[model samples]
Every structure is written in C-alpha cells, then in structure tokens.
Target: MEYEAATRHFAALGHPGRLSVVRLLLRHAPRGVRPTEIAGTLGMKSNTLSHHLAELEGAGLIGSAREGRSLFYTVRLPELAALIAYLGQDCGRGRPDLMPTHPTEIDMDRPFNVLFICSGNSARSIFAEAILRSLGGTRFRAFSAGTRPNSVLNPFAIEVLERNGLDTSGLRSKHVAEFEGPEAPRMDFVFTVCDQAASDECAPWPGQPLTAHWGMPDPAKAEGTDAEKGLAFAKAFGELHRRISAFTQLPFDQLERLALQQHLDRLGEA
Candidate 1:
C-alpha cells in the first residue's frame, strides 16, 4: 500500500479553494508565499485562509518555514511528485504504447466510470454526481441522469454546487434512456441514490456494472418555509460529502467483486 499520509494529502487537495491555492504555489514554485500574502491574494480572511493552509501543510503539499517573524509557505516538490505518482500509479497496462510511468496504486487501467440514477436527476442524484466529480480523482469519473427526466436542473441544486465551488456551467439533465443506446458511454458502477430509481428494472448493458442503493432523501421534496427548504439542502449536502469520501477511499485492486459489492452496500449505513 502507498503511504496513508499521501492519501490524506490528496484528500486535502480535493477542495476547490485548496486546489486553487496549490495551483498558485505550483505557479510560484521554489519561491514561497507568506500567509498574509496568500490570504490577501485569494481575498480570503486571514483566519479562514490560515485554516486551509494548515490543512495543506498537514497533507505535506506545502512546507512552512520561519523567516524572522514571518512564516513562508513553499510548495514541496517531492510531495507534489508523490501525489502525481499516486494518482497515476495504475496508468497503462498490457499495452506497450500506453505504459504509464506514474501508475496509481488503485486499478486505473480501466478508470471506473460511475453513474448515479434517481427519479428527477434534479437534486440528490445531481448533487451526488457533482460531489464525486469534484472529489473523485482521475481514477473515477461520475455521471447522473433521471429515470423520468426533468426539463431543467433544479435551481437549489445548482446553488448548493456553486456555493461548494463546483462549476455548474457545463452540467445538464437528461433521461436514463440516453445511457441505454448502443453508443452510450461505458459504466463501471451504477448507483441509485433514491428508493424509486433503485427498484426499477431496466435494460441490460455492457459490464453489467455493480448496482447499489444509497436511499438519499430528496431535498427537493422538502416543504415549508424558505429556511426549512434550505435545511433540507444542507442535510443532503452533508450526506453526499460523507458518502463521496467513503466511495473514493475504496481500494478497488485489493477487494474482490463480492467484497467490493459488500463495501458499497454498506455505504451510508450509519
């Protein structure tokens, strides 16, 4: 197994703001930035940015060294290299032309493609897909669609995603039928996060991707005042965050099909 510290490092970098900070450091490699300067440049409050910086440092992406009374943060080249190597640890396999120098530890010769299915594909499923897309690395790709499609993406869904720093400009809603065609994209995993979509029997497909039910409650169905509705969205967001963390943490290579199935089945059980 690769270093656990390195995985935590990658997890810390998964956040959009943190990813931006890392990119900034990469652009200014060798030359370190001070905490105050970083906060000012990112337009983030000193306290908020400091918390994020500390997390990055804990993950070993950035190193802090004291310079007189000030602390300077510099990108750690070896750490960055390790992160890249970890993500690419399972690159090309069985093909001479596609051999990868930095293969990921997890099996990525076939990057797992996951599809999230739900009734409307407006709130819960869309949120799950976006969270995975934002959190999951190159080893996994995520898509979502509704069994009975909606004409538009839910406004609240877009709001929550954007608040979490995900770009919703490119997201769209579609019917599950789109994936049934012969030319549809290959799926390695299919998850129905709502009870309705999980029970529906549908057409067969290639790979016969493993199926699981997450039973995430529908935020859109929440009724009452604006505050109550917002609470529903918050609840859904927290649930998705917890679930996505567990899903990406899976060691696909180490587990057999049955074990993997059991692991996925137990997700969100708590």
Candidate 2:
C-alpha cells in the first residue's frame, strides 16, 4: 500500500490546513516537529491539529516517535521515496514508449477481507459471513470457519440464507486451521462469535487482523422443535444482517485503527 495508499494520502492532504501542516513538517525534516510546536506555528487549535495529525498518520505519510512526554511527528521519507519509485518504474528511465502520459490511478474500492470465527462453523458465525457478503459485497470479502468444524452447514442456516436470496451452494463448514497458514488471504477484520473461553480453541491467524468479539447465543445449540430452531437461526440472521448493514456504511478508509476498533465493538453491542 503506497503512501498508506496514495488515495488516502491525497485525501488527507486535500484540506488546506492539513496540506499546510504537511509542508511545515517537511521543512522540519529528519529531526521532526513537536505537537506543541506544530500547533503554535500553524496557529491551529490543539483539537483541530490533532484531527489533522490523526488523518495524516492514518494515511502513512507521517509517523510519530516519543520524545519525553511529547510525541514528535515527521514525514515518512522512505515511504514517499517508495511511492516515487513506483510511479517512475513504469517510465522505463525516460522511455517515451513506456511512460504514461496521464497521472497514475488508484482503485480506492479495494475490498477489505473479513473472517468470522466460531466453535462450530454451523450457525451464528456462518450467518455473519453470509450476511456481510450479501450486504457489503462491494467493499468486503467475508469468510467463516470454526475451531472444529462438523464438515456440514446447519441445514437451517442454509435455508435461512436461501430464503433471503443469499447463495449457499458451497457453504461447507471448514476448520480455522485452513486460513492460519501463509497461503491464506490477509484479513483486515476478524470477528470471533465464540465466547472468550472457547475462543482459545482457534489458533491465532498469521496476519495481525483487527479483531473483536461479537458473541451471540449459538443458534445451533437450540434444543427444541423444528419451528423453534428455525426461529433461533432467523433471529441470528436478522441481527447479523443489521450489523453488516450498519458496518458497510462506515467511512472505513477515513477512520484510524483505534476509532475503527471502537466502532466495531459498539456495532456488536447494538
């Protein structure tokens, strides 16, 4: 992701104040600028400057290192250099034939991969994955697996999905181990539907994904007549669909990690 993603950098720099602040930081260079000094020089309120700094930091164009009790902010020159090299790589050292006449483009809609984990890949977690896929297919790739899968989806879960016009053709249960290795896709978010005690059963994934616990009563564990079990799956499906709908509306790229994590936690509670 060049420049914390070129689109993000451009977005963060689009504001006049942020642009000016970046230029100021650039002047300070390798030594860095203290937060107080930046606010004083820019004549910006501390809260306003903090907002700009968070945006810049999230875009990867800037970094901070602690100095005493204060944090010093500075441009990430190496990242900037890498972005320059990436843009120039296509120029073929001034080869007219290879160089693009127009500016480079970035696909800002790149999907963020999400994984849902549960004790059994049967009901709640599976429902979450399917709900997110159907609701946020434009911006998310959703997956689900269990610590110890039973090798079959709960028949009721499939029925609920199909009833809502969601595909269920290849919705077989899988072990979480399948996605723990190097070959697995890099996940941006990991939602654990199992409680804390049972969560330990699934091995930690390779990528340090942003994770949260969105536990719900496991619908598959309902011991009742067919109608009662169906009702349970339906409730889980409705709840997951509501959460996914709300999640997809978030300004995902604009949010810093901590803010994004907080939103995810709150979404589960709602």
Instruction: Give the runs in model 1 whose Cα sits over 4 Å from its true position.
Output: 1-107
Q: Tens digits of per-residue lDDT for model 1 on 27-99?
A: 3445566777677666778888888888998887889899899898878877777666555564322354443
Clashes of each: 7, 0
Write down the lDDT of every candidate, Cα atoms only: 0.76, 0.75
TM-score, prediction 2: 0.58
TM per candidate: 0.59, 0.58
Evaluated at residue 181, the lDDT of candidate 1 is: 84
Candidate 2 regions exceeding 4 Å error are: 1-109, 196-198
lDDT of 1: 0.76
Please give, for residues 106-166, the per-residue lDDT of candidate 2 as tens digits: 1246788899888788887788888888788678899998877455788999999999999
